[model samples]
Target: MSGNTARRPLRADALRNYERILAAAQGAFAAHGASASLEEIARQAGVGSATLHRHFPSRRSLLEVVFHDRVEALCAKAQERAEENEPGAALFSWLGDLNAYAAASRGLVASLLHDGRDTDLLQQNDSCKTMITTAADELLRRARQAGAVRPGVHTEDLLTLVSAISLATEHPDDEQAGRLLDIAIHGIRLHQHQRAATNRETPARFSE
Candidate 1:
């Protein structure tokens, strides 16, 4: 079955088992990547392999659900950071968090990318990519309005840069990923000197 296929609502007891399996799979995948053992996940979840199979049907399905949940949490964190920090600070801080998340969740990223059948999943309705872009766009918009980011900076470019940094530092090295993110953010931010120079070069009417 396709990972995104809908199913009928599960019973209360079955729902508990399903949630347990998902939680176990998340931890296992984090530690062992996409190849983590299903049997081990079942054991950790206190469910039988048959029970896990019943809920998830396939490893891909389980991975999709787990990955989707993680993305949702990441997007929520972006919202929280936006509310707590200045526009530029919040945008850069969330980018750092996103970089760390992508680095640590290499397995999940691999699973999503390795599959050929779902190549358009990122563009699909309610997909992880769409949700992330929406969150990042809001942050980027705020930053630009506050003159924290350069005028030409785009959310897609920021996300792409973060993805590249995560891939280059592929082994869950938060310090390395964070350092690279800082560098990338510095390049995208509008420095006071640069802003002043641009203003000086513009005509008086245009500057206004």
Candidate 2:
């Protein structure tokens, strides 16, 4: 899921064009929100309008590809962080990455959702939504198993939490994002002593 499954193998020349289009599109979206000109994108990619449309028939199609690539990159980062010795540290770091991605993706994702089919691409099989959800599930499972996270914290909760952070920190020079992340981490975590106390309390009540 992390490896960009949205595209199949391409011939060398075709692949070049594909990569060029993606690169150009990414830059354009970053610079001009999601409504950037497709003609300008073709120009930047050094390809014709026909070539661009051949690869991505519509603006929504191109946006889906770009978002897929970005999600793939984030999935890669989540995989890397999952291997760290400290489960809590790894989860927090990945959460920070998620927040950053969400913040940058604000406008672009909105545009995609405006068009129904493009939005479906993200939620459909083998799409970015699946990739991100799988990664978050794995990371959360690991953190909980390591006794760092509280029981019953779902992957959706983590994503939703970060999404809210991104929205709240949309303005320039906002420091609340990091502070909220810290708060979220603490909220989801179970201190060792807290777990031990809970265990003791449960047994005592059952024994009585």
For all predicted structures, in order, the TM-scores are: 0.77, 0.75
lDDT computed for candidate 2: 0.79
Clashing pairs in 2: none
**lDDT score for candidate 1 against the true structure:** 0.81
Model 1 lDDT at residue 42: 100
If candidate 2 were superposed on the true structure by all CA atoms, what would the RMSD be?
4.2
lDDT of the candidates, in the order given: 0.81, 0.79
Q: What's each prediction's clash count?
A: 0, 0
lDDT of 2 by residue, 94-117 (tens): 998888778777766566666444
Q: Ten consecutive residues with minimal summed lDDT in candidate 1?
A: 116-125
Q: Pick the candidate with the highest lDDT.
A: 1
Please state the error at residue 72 of candidate 1 in Å.
1.5
Candidate 1, residues 1-208, lDDT tens digits: the string is 2234577877899888988998899889887767789999999999999999998888877877887877888989999999999999999999988887777687655755675544354445357788899999999999988889766678889989998997888765578778888888889988999788766674455332
